[model samples]
Target: MTTPLGGAPLTSLEQDPAMAGGDADSGDAGDLGPQPVVNRTIGRRHGHHGRNWMGHGRRAKSNPELRGGFDGLNFHDQRYANGGNQFSVEPPDQGLCVGNGFVMESVNDVLAVYDKSGNELVGPVDLNTFYGYPAAINRSTGAYGPSITDPSCYYDSDTRRWFQVVLTLDRVGTTSSLAGTNHLDIAVSQTANPTGAWNIYHLPVQNNGTQGTPDHGCDGGFCLGDYPHIGADNNAIFLTTNEFALFGSGFYGAQIYAISKKALVHGAASPNVVLFNGGDPNIPAPAFTVWPATSPDGQFAGARGGTEYLLSSDAVFYDSGTSNTLWLWSVSNTRAIDKAPTALNLDVSPLTVQDYAVPTSLVQQKPGDTPLRDCFALTGCAPTYLGYPNIVYPTPRPMAVNDSRMQQVTYANGKLWGTLDTDVLLADGTHGSGINYFVINPHSGGLFANGTLALPDANLTYGAAAVTRSGRGVIAFTVVGPDNYPSAGYASFDAKIGAGDVHIAAAGAGPWDGFTGIPYLAGNRPRWGDYGAAATDGDRIWTASEYIAQTCTLTDYLTAPMFQCGGTRGALGNWATRISKFEL
Candidate 1:
């Protein structure tokens, strides 16, 4: 998959084409271009007292609005990958001290980084690097404006390291997937300082063409996609990808791949892609399951490992007939993905099969198909309700049979947080708007629908909910639109705790004080488009999006109170400009 360069690559951005206007070496953002200004006003009153996007649902909110800035944090954007396009930051500790953590991102190439701050006196730093094959581009549109997808980040305090995972999409023309051209790339790096020398490692995948096929059919929807995840457990890292193809261009089928973290992080330079048989760690026979020709969409979360469990979200699919009903298979194992002895030993099974209004599926699908089983779906109009847009994390519980959206379950602040995109049909009898959230009591099953926080605003809605391991609060990013055209605009928002309100080991810790700072927005696009996806490491938030020329580029970045969350009034920067540090 490696594309050979014609000559020694241009040593710096100064010499690369498509590199201009902004200074490549200096982090100084240039003059604001011709862009419109939209006034944004955030206040405590706007917060509905922890209520979710919908007033009464599953997830619960303590304090909706948080504070303005965190002290001592830095944001960095790495330029080594596709046009220095990805961004990450090393977050500060609880008391404004530089933290020993780092995160990195990229397109098509695996983006990973490592930093040490609190554990050792090493300088708090941010580092990022990429190792993967480049995309084959169109002579006209230029890789068809290929952008990064499903980007994720992580921190390992024990190893004093940070890791990033991203899917580099490849396309031959303006629309659709490119066969065999798209593959996974993993890059690992070590950070000793915020800016200095670093080591790099690259791993390319070797596929058997059996377990992972870009093509499959579910509910008439053909095998359509892949979202891969990397997790740490038992002192080792694991990698895996979800297999789902669109049947009839609508529904999805399910399948999964679990790679050994030991092989990726500690094994030989070349590692082969491995499949999960079930839950057994002793059997070596390869018998991973493929989506039966009838499942809907297949989705997978990053791998998670611990002394007790190996967890992942296997596939999130909708039944073909109606949009109201949806299903999720939360795959779990007692042993880590790398240690699973046999395919059958892996314990791959669905614990819960949830049901929601058909319209609710519209949240993730946005302006696409509205099936009958969908909870948000109404008779003759658009379906409402939306759920998590990024990736989902798994916990010790096996709720696949009772859960339809695995991305809703997350580990943060040392506790478990769940979000549900509740579909509520208005009394008027027309299918429309609804609620989405984090901080729900999943133990009550989907019946206890409550979110930790809620959006009272009439225009904006929430979905993808992420929480840091601490669980004090979870970060919820917004996806703004159903208007369809990119001209209407879409923005991302974040809410964190206020310094005056934070009280550890006390009840006040969970209440939403309403973010003190102005809500952050992904800069508006000159053309119509949407935010890519979001990820986090407790203290800071990150997201990605694809660009089309003067329109946009799929880019990711870190947003914390300390970083001040750019894209506010007087801020005319692209997502790439707000970065304070660079990893790779």
Candidate 2:
């Protein structure tokens, strides 16, 4: 089922003629103008507790089940359920690519390919095999090689090529510490067919001695690129990463890497790389996780070449104060990347937005269903036939919500669109998790329009959006709370106006898991995945999310048979992914 391809080490920058030039600077690189002030708050409210859960221990005295606010518009339809293989434990970390009448979906370590009709073509294969590496590796010391995680894929219509990227670590056991080498592996399809041979490139990610001195804000001794996101324009491709100290000791800031898209797609032996850090002299303090936005329709309608943009939220932690500013970075002269003695220009700018508080835990409950107090104790009534010890009600313990970060972004129809998870004030005066959608004028650096979408009692988080050439767009996100199971939902909107009412695209079959605490999870919370994905193929928008399977079956925790449950070597059904196609 798998093969071993070993690892590819970083090539010497000097040996590569394309990287001979000195780094470029835009107006003294470090001297950015004064920070952009918040023009005005779009969604403002009071009585916000940083991390409050209203339904933690109390049951409703008497009330009907709460439902989402619907706009009465049904312009979207699910074309097919291209169910993905179960791969990762919690928080599925899903990604999707659809183009040329084909679809490809990837979870943490597994990838699957299908036709437009949802017919399986190839794969359900381990990421290692596809990357030319051993199928399985030693978990403790990483004997065979580093384990692959956090994969993202994109389809480039201009060149008819597909790109897949993943982060590889030395060993699976040392996740909390940066004790071994780390790498970001990139694979570009040689032709339109994804199942055929491909070119693989690896870039070292750890802060080793050879990585050059880090910027002032980076932890020089132990830097690792965590949560790498991918985006692209016609002239170049971008990879944004959150640089962190090996053991999560310090947050360094975001790292943006630019590569030649033309060179990669053409099968060049070695492609030149340009790197940018937010800390240098521009965005000095309180800046982290700069997410790069990719153009959904491929490069903008601009008349210029070699230009790309990135965005970041001033606030990092969920408990941090409400943020009213967004940092923007523009990299120009990217066309010079492959030419020696030429460098790219980088600029950083900050813009003010409406002050928004950090998101709080969402409540999801079924009618007359008492919340499970102790899932491990097996003392509560079960919803599905799986019986007790299943994932507890409200799935994630303590009802924690995702942080406010731009989950996914797209550039289309002369506008940049993005969405993030945030706490919103409902019409009834209740605070709930909701999606914040905002648009920006890339050319003028102005905030175009922004609004919030929240249901009465439901919490929505981990959202993704895509836009069409006609200025029509759709947003896909997860809905969960005390009144509902984790479900996949979406809202469509006309870019000229705003998003329509919420619609449940696909509902979860049951609770995610019965275990309240697990080592892999952060603080024993149910892993709802870092983010979902949405992309447009010019006419139709495709969305994907981590959803629960309709049936229950035992599954391994992570290659260990002893970790099974319910008298099976591997019991406890895990979360699965679903890919759906729709039109606005």
Best by lDDT: 2
Instruction: Report residue 533 deviation for candidate 1 (angstroms).
Output: 6.6
TM-score of each: 0.46, 0.75
* Residue 237 miss distance in model 2 (angstroms): 0.9
lDDT against the true structure, per candidate, is 0.26, 0.57
Q: Model 1: per-residue lDDT, tens digit, 150-218? A: 444444443444445544434445443433233444543354232333333332221323334323323
Go through the candidates in order and give the clash count of each: 125, 23
Weakest ten-residue segment in model 2 by summed lDDT:
72-81
**Model 2: how far is 553 from its true place, Å?**
9.7
Model 1 off-target regions past 4 Å?
1-129, 132-148, 169-181, 191-225, 235-252, 271-273, 277-344, 348-355, 358-408, 412-415, 425-462, 468-470, 479-584
RMSD of each: 16.6, 12.1
